[model samples]
Target chain A: MLGPILETLIGGLLTGVLYSLVALGFVLIFKASGVFNFAQGVMVLFAALSVARLSEFFPMPIAIALAVVVMIALAYAIEFLVLRRLVNQEGIILFMATLGVTYFLEGFGQTVWGSDIYKIDLGMPKNPIFVLESVFPGGLLIDPSELIAALICAIMVVALAIFFQVTRVGRALRAVADDHQAAQSVGIPLNQIWLMVWAVAGIVALVAGMMWGAKLGVQFSLSLVALKALPVLILGGFTSIPGAIVGGLIIGAGEKLAEVVLGPVLIRMFDLAGGGIENWFAYVLALMFLLVRPQGLFGEKIIERV
Target chain B: MLYREAGQFKTSYSADQAIFSIAQDRWFVMIVLLLGFVGVPLVANQYLYTEVFIPVLILSIAAIGLNILTGYCGQVSLGTGGFMAVGAYAAYNLALRIPDMNFILVFALSGVVAMLVGVLFGLPSLRIKGFYLAVATLAAQFFLEWAFARVKWFTNYAPSGSVAVGKIELFGFAIDTPDRKYLFVLALVVVMALAAKNMVRGRLGRSWMAMRDMDIAAEIIGIRPLNAKLSAFAVSSFYIGVAGALWGFLRLGSWEPLAFDINRSFQVLFMIIIGGLGSILGSFLGAAFIILVPIFLNQLPHLLGIPLSTAAVSHIEFMVFGAMIVFFLIVEPNGFARLWAIAKEKLRLWPFPY
Candidate 1:
């Protein structure tokens, strides 16, 4: 029993890292622009589609590089076309604009790249390796793809932390996030910073898309991962990077454990057809957490002054 | 000018406080309502009733419901679909179990049931705000959707997990025909829309708007956040729930849980946004636009004699819808109702401009 539970926990944690990768894009865009970017999921799907389809013509490396360029162009286009005109609007309106972007990206990705599921092969090993054989009877089986995803997530987090700490552009980004007017008054170009942040977020979407597409095969449903990341944001706090990571891990693990453990009890109690509690478990957990700490675990404390 | 209201006068408080203060406005509304009730049934075909009018009217109720919460109360919700599902399923079960119950009472009871669910989900609004609140509402959406799908009792243990109703009889009149369904839906929608308009005009509506514009300020002004916010949720869900029942019973006639999915929530949200937030009339206009635009897009290629696959047309429709949303948000965030108001304003001026 312990071995099975431990194995599930480890598997959930690895999956949680992937969620963190997606949540990072949302956090980056939200922190910099104060816009809750609803299009992040579609952006992931779009990036993955771009890479997958482009690889059909070009070498893998060239396809990836082209995909990066495409993402950057998309970043610039969103900033110029959508965000630039809607300055000083309400957060909800900006959020709605992102929804518009989401629909556009979904249509555009499907139109440009045929609406069929495409696979990404990073040449990662397909077999699962067993670890701690002596401790458990059958040992714990782990997917190498998930491990690679975790490694990539870790590297990105470290790189982002260092960039924010040591680079001038990163400092400007932080200052812009703190206060838009004050940051602008101090000679930081708001447009440039927004473009940069969006571009970085686009790159993050690319990496997330690749990882997710490799794991599940690139399809329209890949966009639904955005819904999954939303609970992670609720748990982590919309504007905190580290909060996103921790929140993702907690949500991912909690949902999995609940689905495995509590799902059966509910199924038996209610005579449900099957156990699929993970569908809403993460959200309910985040909602409960929010009731206790509305600001989120690592979110900056909200101070409202009339 | 034809649109001018310069000569209209009110001698009493009731007249001054009337929903339509202008005589011309009153006359126009009367004409429109008369046409809707009497003129439409005379000349309309079955296709128009089934394909166009019924859906528009049903969705308008939902749009109004969402407008009351997200537009007036300033609470963002992504769970309109869930509340709607509650109404649909509630109506289904009530009609199934109590075969002798009046259809009207069944619909009302479904609204009441959905109201309770809405209030329960809305409890989180006190703790969270903005996008967080939106996500919390999504929890309600997913949970309710999942429950309706998983809990066999809700569907009456239908093997296919879908529910259907037999012929609906109200007051010994069989409402089996398309025109009858349209009239039934139209009557309910008109009553509900008027009720919503009145509710929003009164002190209750004021309290909701107060909470929406600024919650802290509204609290300072002696409006209880708990009462104001929960009431908005209750009223909004009540309206949406009835719409859902109408959608399930009158429009679709049969539906699975997918009938009121998250996409439905987004569709209603889009209606309010495109119609004009915080305006009752905007809900109708937005609903009409959202429903009509796709149909128009589907026909555009054919009209132009351009041969395009259905898939391509759908993709283009999506692109156009998305573009239109962004365009509307950028150009006129107030939506079509604002444009209509502007048109009215211009008409009042007529051939003269300052």
Candidate 2:
């Protein structure tokens, strides 16, 4: 029992880190645009599908490199073509546009790569790392790839933090996030800022896609997991990157623990006979969080002026 | 000119405040209802009734329910399918446990069960609003889907995790036939639609609209946010629950939890969005649009004598449908119901510029 618990915790941490990566992309876009891009998950699927197909057809390294470039281009194309035209639309309209984007990308990805799931081999060294046993506390083991994923996430988060805090364009992006009108008053080109932010978000999504694809294989179901990030965004506050990471960890660990511990108990209580709690565990946890703290763990308190 | 309402003059407050005050509008609605309930079953074939009419009617009922919440109350939900599943399963259990239970009573009771679930889930909306609220409701969707799928008793311990109704009857007339099923659905839809139309026009409806417009202001004006929001959830779920019963009992006849998946929720949501968010008439129009468009798209290629695989056709249909959503959002974000109102406004001022 203790062994499985520790193993689950380590696995949960790794999964949480990956979820944080996806959540970060959402935070960046929501912070910048105030539009919750429902398509973020689809973008992950699209990126993974692109990488999987490219690697299949071309040299692995070159395909990975080209896939990154394609994602960046796609990001720029979306910004230029669709989002550019929708600059001043209502928030709901923007949300709907993203839904449209979700559909388009899903159909487009399936069309390009076919709907079959593909095994993605990124040529990472698949050796288990001997980490401190004390950390996990009971012969809990983690794969080297997951540690690498966590490291990558840490680096990405730190890089994003620095980019936002130290860079001029980052400051401009911050300005836009604060107030679109005020940002314009400061002579920040709103359209350019939006395009740049969207591109950055795309990059974040690409990394998330690669990491998740490595774990789950490149498939449409990956997009569904991306939907799980919405609750993370809610819990972490839409505008807070650190909040996203923390929220992801809590949700990830919480879901796994619930499944392993309380799931069977509830199943027995309800006389459900067969235990399967992990399926809705995450959502139920999110819902509980929503009821208690609508602003989320790190979200700013919403003040309505009307 | 045939649609003119020149002599329609309201003399009493009841007449003035009537659902269809305009004589022509009333006549037109009555005719449509008659055609739907009585006429369609007579003239339409089995395929039209089974594949088209019953499905459309059931979806319209669900759309009307969603419209009450999202359209009028301004509480966006992503759990209509979940609530529908609750209703479907509840009805299934009610029918199975009480072998001699009335099918209609079971259907109505299933709606109450859904209402309870909707209210339980709706508790989050009290603190959450807008997109946050939508996410909260999505939790309901996934949770309900999982519960139904995993819980063996919910499916009556079915081996394949699917549920089916035994048979349905109303007063010893077997509703097994397609035309009979269509009539049953059409009758329920008409009754529910009328109830919805009336409800939305009353005090409760006004309160809901006020809350949707501005919750703070509505609160200031003494409308209890808890009451308005929860009632919206309750009533909306009640309607959606009944529709789910019909959908399972009449339309699909057998289904897994996937039948009420998130995709179905989005389909109903898109119907309300594209039809008219706050209009009862829009629900039907939206449901018709959503239901028929794919069918029409699928048939068009075949009708044109083009040879294409169903998969390819479905792909094109998705692309076209997705593009149409963006188009409608851009063209008239208020929805197809607004378009109808605009046309009516124009018709009221025919042959005159100003």
Report chain B TM per candidate: 0.98, 0.97
The TM-score between candidate 1 and the true structure equals 0.99
Name the lDDT of candidate 2: 0.86
Model 2 chain B poorest 10 in a row by lDDT: B345-354
Q: What is the lDDT of residue B259 in candidate 1?
A: 91
lDDT per residue as tens, model 1, A1-306: 999888889889999998989999999999999999999999999999999999999989999999999999999999999999999999988988999999888888899998998989889999999999999999999998899999999999999999987999999999999999999999999999999999999999999999999999999999999999999998999999999999989988888889888999999999997878899999999999999999888888889988
- Can you give the lDDT of residue A80 in candidate 1? 99
Q: What is the lDDT of residue B77 in candidate 2?
A: 95
List model 1 lDDT by residue over B278-336, tens digit each. Answer: 99999999999999988898889999999988888888889899998999999998888
What lDDT tens digits, residue by residue, belong to model 2 across residues B234-353? 999999998888888888889999999999998999898888889999999999999998889889999999998777777677777777777787678888888898888777767563
Residue A51, model 2, lDDT = 83
**Model 1 segments beyond 4 Å from truth?**
none
DockQ for all candidate structures vs. native: 0.82, 0.57
**In model 2, where do residues sit more than 4 Å from their true spots?**
A85-88, A130-138, B1-7
